[model samples]
Target: MEEEECLSHSSPSTDNSLELRLQRVTAENIKTVRILVSSIFPVSYSDKFYQECMNNELTGVVIRNGEAIAIVAVKPENFETGRVLYIRSFGVHPRHREAGLGSFLMDFVDEKGKLLKLPHAMLHVQTSNKTAIEFYKNRGFNVDCLVPQYYQRCSPPDAFIMRKPFH
Candidate 1:
């Protein structure tokens, strides 16, 4: 991730035209979200995984402009016997990034997790993805653990599992 100059933070209401809406993802949007994921990650979306997201067993959000511009998927997990949410895929369109959209989506997820009473929100980031690591860390995520050779096919960086506790 490139270290571009930080943009000014804007209030949610200030960017009403560039709305960030969170809804239960449907089958139709899964493909588009998959495209979004593929654009950011090295993994390809499998048919079964897309189906699971559309089935509502997994939670997702679509940030759109009459079409999916960005998407996030979370799988609920039982951590420490408490409900936890792991962000499975999160990506903003390359064209729309650096305009506060990522932060908006993240804020939306944080609110949703709080409402769901999740103990913490977790995600894994490649060590080479400095921009994503900085973004999460700035949003209160702490590096919880490191896994070696996590994405062996794509890059040679260790995986950093970061988590942000809600309570």
Candidate 2:
């Protein structure tokens, strides 16, 4: 089935409010995703990044009261270790932080990873982003290694490759 069709059939596990729903990214809502990303993260993404989000089944947004409040976009990639789910971008809007949206979106990713049998989930977190690092660690992820200058335009470009093995 098409990813968008799959999304239309499935329902959010916890959210029963009609005003709050999860939807897959599409050409129509891609703009909203970009705007939300810009507001939450300091980095700018490439055109290819946004394109992947619209085409991939693992990319999605949390809509609350007609606005995207969180996003989790991922892709499956072949690593030296094997197939892994790479989180390309993930963030909850600043206004929605500390309201459990981050954890909720993460749980959504974990479910997607398992459904795809990806075996592991990986993402990069800026070394200076202590909150994100702690959040990943709390979700059973470990700092796999430091990648110096991973980010080109961000301050303290260094990043840590965090991974969670959950086969």
Candidate 3:
């Protein structure tokens, strides 16, 4: 994505009042990203995870009104055939749901994958999270496999590896 491209969203009080933009994660916004992830997911991330976010070229946050309302952190991984974009963390703030922010971040991921010439994008989601499963499926992801007890502390603990192949 361009360094300063803006996404305009309409508001009840004013037309296109909310301005959103994708920005790289930095020391200044690291805490905000940690909080955003905690609020959206049931998992706790390590300091190393946040540290890696700062260095990953594909990691970014969606800032709206100068606050981070969404995030998509990704990295490349080698599977059996080739390297794939591994979506480490991706979510929009609960309050911002259904506003197309999720899709916006996803489109960003797709563009990055194509630019990098990755064969596929993959992520794991809790099997119980039907909403997320449906969302990924709608974006052309399929369950590659079931990982039992993928999460140590989460109830049901199982996860499904969802993958979207780039054609």
**Residue range 1-167, candidate 3, lDDT tens digits:** 22433323212312266544677777666677778889998988888888888845688787655567798888889877578999999998998888778887887788788988998999989999999999999999999999999999998899999999988
Structure candidate 3, residue pairs in collision: none
- Please report, as a residue range, the 10-residue window in candidate 3 with the lowest summed lDDT: 6-15
Q: By lDDT, highest first, what's the ranking? A: 3, 2, 1
RMSD of each: 7.6, 3.5, 4.4
Worst 10 residues of 2 by lDDT: 1-10
Model 1 steric clash total: 0
Better-scoring candidate (TM-score), 1 or 2: 2
lDDT of each: 0.70, 0.80, 0.81
lDDT of 1 by residue, 23-134 (tens): 5566556556766777777767677777776646245455354456666677777765366788877877787778777787777667668778888999889888889999
The numbered model that scores best in lDDT is 3
Candidate 3, which segments miss by more than 4 Å at Cα? 1-15
Q: How many residue pairs clash in each candidate?
A: 0, 0, 0
Q: How close is every model to the real structure, measured as TM-score?
A: 0.79, 0.86, 0.87
What does the lDDT read for residue 37 in candidate 2? 88
Q: Better model by lDDT, 1 or 3?
A: 3
Write the candidate numbers in order of decreasing TM-score.
3, 2, 1
